[model samples]
Target: MSRVLIVDDAAFMRMMIKDILEKNGFEVVGEASNGFKAVEIYKNEKPDVVTMDITMPDMDGIEAVKAIREFDSNAKIIMCSAMGQQTMVMDAIRAGAKDFIVKPFQAERVLEAIRKAIG
Candidate 1:
């Protein structure tokens, strides 16, 4: 099973992602609510994949992606973004996110991003 780390400021968002990932055979290794925490957890857990939220307090997803990439260039990160944040999404991609999933996350899309990212 692929190990995953979910990073989102909203607890409910994290829970929702956890449920989706768990049901689809992905092992959620850790979760973080902010970019700083995300980076910390990424270093410790070293999960195979990461689902990162673009907008967050104390660091945001783009910065987190950069930080993680600095630590591990091979990191596979799938950015989660809300609608209307197209610019941010592009920035995340530039920061080394392998893929992205828009909010109001559909199960299949999330799974697809994860699969593609991990592959």
Candidate 2:
């Protein structure tokens, strides 16, 4: 099973992702509410994939992606974006995110992105 780290400002969003991932047989290694914590968790847990939220308080997903990529070039990050954040998504991709899923998330899409990212 792929180990996943979920990052979002909302606890509910993190809970939702955890539900979807665990149901799909993905192991949730860690979770973080902001980009700063996300980076710290990435280093500590070293999850195979990360589902990162775009607009966060400490640091945005794009900056977190860059930080993780810097720490581990092979880091696989999947941005979790809201509907209107197309530009931010693009920036995340450029920052080395492997893929992305939009919110409110579909379990299937989330699983697909994780599969593709791990591949």
Candidate 3:
């Protein structure tokens, strides 16, 4: 099972992501509510994939992706954000995210992104 880290400002959003990944047999090794903690957890836990929320109170996901990539070139990240932020999503991809998911997330889409990201 692939280990996953979920980063979202909303507790409910993180819970939803955990539920989806666990149901798909993915091991959720850690979670962070902000981008700063996301990178910390990424380094400490070394999760196989990360589902990162774009708009968080501290650090934001784009910069976090860059920071993590600077340390670990092969870090697998999947950006998760609300619709209508195509530019931000593209920016996340440029920052080394392997895939992107629009929020109000569907379980299947999340799984697909996870599968692709981890693979």
Candidate 4:
């Protein structure tokens, strides 16, 4: 089972992800509301995967991904992006996110990205 860190500004989104990951046999190790906390949690939890939101209040996911990658070159990340965020998604990938899932999430697609990211 993989330990995962979930970073989203929305409380509901975090809960949804935690529920989905838990039901799918992945551990939700930590949750963060913004990119700054995301990086802090990443360091503390050292989860196997991180599901990061692109448009966050502080720092944003792209910068957070880069910061995480700086500390851990092989850190596995899956970006959670809204529709029509192709440019940000691409930036996230370039910043070292392994894959991305578009919202509102489908269980299958989210799982696929998770599997692909950690596999």
Candidate 5:
């Protein structure tokens, strides 16, 4: 199973993603409620993939992606955005995210993105 780190400011969102990933046989290695913690946990855990929320507190997903990529250029990141955040998604892509998933969490899309990213 691929190890994954989930990053979001909302506890419920993290729980939802954890549930989805675990049910589908992915191992959830760590979770973070802010971008700062996301970066720190990422460095420590070194998960195979990351699902990052865009509008997080203290650094944001884009910045976290850049930081993680700096630490490991091959880092595979997937940005999780709400509908209508096209520009921010573009920014995230530019920052080195491998792919993106739009929320409110669709299991299939999430899995697809993760599979494609880790490939």
Candidate 6:
């Protein structure tokens, strides 16, 4: 199973992603409520993939992607955004995210993004 780290400010969002990932055989290595914690956990845990929320408290997903990519050029990050955040999504892509998943998430899509990212 691929190890994953979920980053979202909302506890419920994190729980939802964790549930989906665990149900589909992905191991959740860690979780963070904001980009700062996300970066720290990522460095320590080194998960195979990360699901990053767009609008976080301290640092946003785009910045986190850049930070992670700077640390590990091959980091696999998947941005998670709500509808109508296309520009931010593009920014995340530019920052080195491998893929993106829009919320409220669909289980199938989330799984697909993670699978493709890890691949």
lDDT of 2 by residue, 1-119 (tens): 89999999999999999999998899999999999999999999999999999999979899999999999999999999999999999999999998889999999999999999999
| Per-residue C-alpha lDDT of model 5 across residues 1-119, encoded as one tens digit per residue | 89999999999999999999999999999999988899899999999999999998878999999999999999999999999999999999999998999889999999999999999
Q: What's model 4's lDDT at 52?
A: 96
lDDT of 5: 0.94
lDDT of 4 at 22: 97
Write model 6 residue lDDT over 63-82, tens digit each, in one string. Answer: 99999999999999999999
Model 1 per-residue lDDT tens digits across residues 1-119: 99999999999999999999999999999999999999999999999999999999999999999999999999999999999999999999999999999999999999999999888
Instruction: For model 4, give the 10-residue run with minimal summed lDDT.
Output: 110-119
Tens digit of per-residue lDDT, candidate 4, span 1-119: 89999999999999999999999999999999999999999999899999999999868999999999999999999999999999999999999999999999999998999998888
Name the regions of candidate 1 deviating beyond 4 angstroms: none
What's the TM-score of each model vs. the native?
0.98, 0.98, 0.97, 0.98, 0.98, 0.98
Residues 27-88 of candidate 3: C-alpha lDDT, one tens digit per residue? 99999999889989999999999999999996999999998898799999999989898999
Candidate 5 stretches with Cα past 4 Å from truth are none
Angstrom error of the Cα, residue 27, model 1: value is 0.6
lDDT of each: 0.96, 0.95, 0.93, 0.94, 0.94, 0.95
Backbone clashes, each candidate: 0, 0, 0, 0, 0, 0
Worst 10 residues of 6 by lDDT: 56-65
- Residue 16 of model 4: what lDDT? 93
Specify the poorest-scoring 10-residue window by lDDT in model 3. 110-119
Q: Which residue pairs collide, candidate 4?
A: none
The residue ranges of model 3 lying beyond 4 angstroms of the native Cα positions read: none
